[model samples]
Target: MSETPFDPTVLLSDDLLERFRERAAVHDRENTFPDDDLADLKAAGYLAILVPTELGGAGLGLAEASLLQQRLAGAAPATALAVNMHLVWAGVAKVLADRGIDSLRFVQEGAVTGEVFAFGISEAGNDLVLFGSDTDAAPRPDGTYAFTGTKIFTSLAPVWTQLGLHGLDTTSDDAPQMVYAFVPRSDAVVTRDDWDTLGMRGTQSRTTELHGATAPADRVVRRLAPGPNPDPIVFGIFSVFELLLASVYTGIARRALDLAVATAQRRTSKRTGTSYSQDPDIRWRIADMALAYDALPPQIASLCRAVDEVVPPDGRWFSYMSGVKHRAVTMAKAVVDDAVLVAGGSSYFASAELGRLYRDVLAGLFHPSDPESAHSTVATAWLGPLDT
Candidate 1:
């Protein structure tokens, strides 16, 4: 776990990746969840990858998990994206445990038992993200909280056993506290089958409505004040979420670049009497894709290792992680665009993998720490907050 690299082949073998790749297209076409892919990943102990060895898990650090995600994404972007939610909670548990806090250890333990945890923090239009919540977390006399609100983009909606979420509690001793808690799938939790989208169809990321969904007191994790805070829970979730997101997009970039190279080499031009690989324009485009994609993995890895070692981020964690994510997503989109050009008209077809990547990469722009937010975060870091 101390070392930053893990052998992905042992877990995500070539055969496994191919299976995922094959199923990816079917799932995308049908707009269905990759149920078989999930079964395979669970059978391979991938669900427990971030959990500690003592807990019967992989015991790997964030850096290794990031690499594994990249490998998984290269073959099945939707599956990797769905699984990232599970890893986020597990990563947060490890972060807390390493810091001498054991409240979230149950999440690690649950992963070993094949339980799936989905992130449920996103709302329809709550731009505050982790800093605030619009969902109501009303406390009951029995010490349980009834969370009533809608959470959009709930990945793993069909399979998640537990939903980790946050909501604002207005009646607590500290009014307006953001309560971080988890609720098991129950009658109170309603998931609408409305996940159809332009890309990442295999994810089945539907909308979830919590109709007074109850989280027992023991399930409640953190109760921090609303707004940005340097608490471990906030920092841990932010670090893991941003790093893993970057890894997935970097993997997409890797795939696009690889496909572009293969297409250029195989495509021959009668006008030039040589493969497109010999064309200067195609070569420059491929190189441009590589030049943009190469720096991402290293950047994500270094930040992940820093997160693993618990380095003092000096209040710069937001800017650091968000900047990496924003850049990776934008660069991946550009790479996929170039890849389509290299592949010729064939790539424009809906069945083409490059076309799928082009669509999947667009989802990156909608993820947390978007372009505007990322730029604002960095600007505030370097130049301080705006004037009142």
Candidate 2:
């Protein structure tokens, strides 16, 4: 109901965002998680924003959550990226519950009580992503499943209480069903302190190794045929993950645009003896940045609204979702590139905010629905699958 509609500004204040901005560089320089930012957001009831009011959350929908993420990302990309994992599970739970699959009600309840849920789907070189898993999901007589494998790029690794992941159950009657489950942090779950990266370091997206980590029967959320099915779980995860990711990158574009404008206004051209804002070349660069950025928010909002309205989930939705994510990332990258040039060498300094943004925006290239995959999805939709 948040897109019915809610004000993200009211939910996230300027003062709060400024605080995050102030701390972002420090955390980035130190390659550390933004612990203070998380505490502030948790205290502000952000982690539960997508859960229904009946579940004691803000009752917001994907559209509203997208807006909130943009605002959050503008201040601290790493913080926003890390927070996205928690919000994603909440959004997925909302998506499933609205579709009459209320299996993730516990996730909703947990968020209300301040339990952090992290995504643990990614595995090294396992590019099949949601449709497949390298992890083993061994079923027990009690109906629980023990997952044994390593999950890479697990955000919020240090603090997540529940990890939502998928594994392949090759021994089940189905003989290869993909299993989705949530497991609490335990002795079996080990997080490697190996999260040093070029950008978004505050996420601490470390390697997570599940050494026969067990999920109780009730927490085993789904069992579906692997390889791109239209199960509600798959659709839900795709819809929320793509849109939220698009929102984050779009927000980075906006921040870069703003910083460029500010720099242009303050900088002076030696030959013209006036602000760079007056220089045709400088103005053109910023304008180009704006032009590229202008198309993203509306697109993200429209798609998010479509998701909120429960648009038909099929092959077409994946193309649409992936397309938006790909565009957002590409556009953000282009805008940041122009931003660095427009702002001059001063922005090249490691301490510069724009410099952090430049590095952080690059991480977008690696997220799902990557450039190649997004293009392939679009091509298949328009021209049908390549000659078999």
Clash counts for all predictions: 0, 0
Q: Whole-model Cα lDDT per candidate? A: 0.94, 0.93
Q: lDDT by residue for model 2 over 278-337, one digit each (tens)?
A: 999888888888989999999999999887888776667789999999999999999999
Say which candidate scores most in lDDT: 1
- Poorest 10 consecutive residues of model 1 by lDDT? 1-10
Return the TM-score for each candidate structure: 0.98, 0.98
Stretches off by above 4 angstroms in model 2 are 1-5
User: What lDDT tens digits, residue by residue, belong to model 1 across residues 24-76?
Assistant: 99999999999999999999999999999988999999999999999999999
RMSD of candidate 1 to the truth, in angstroms, is: 1.4
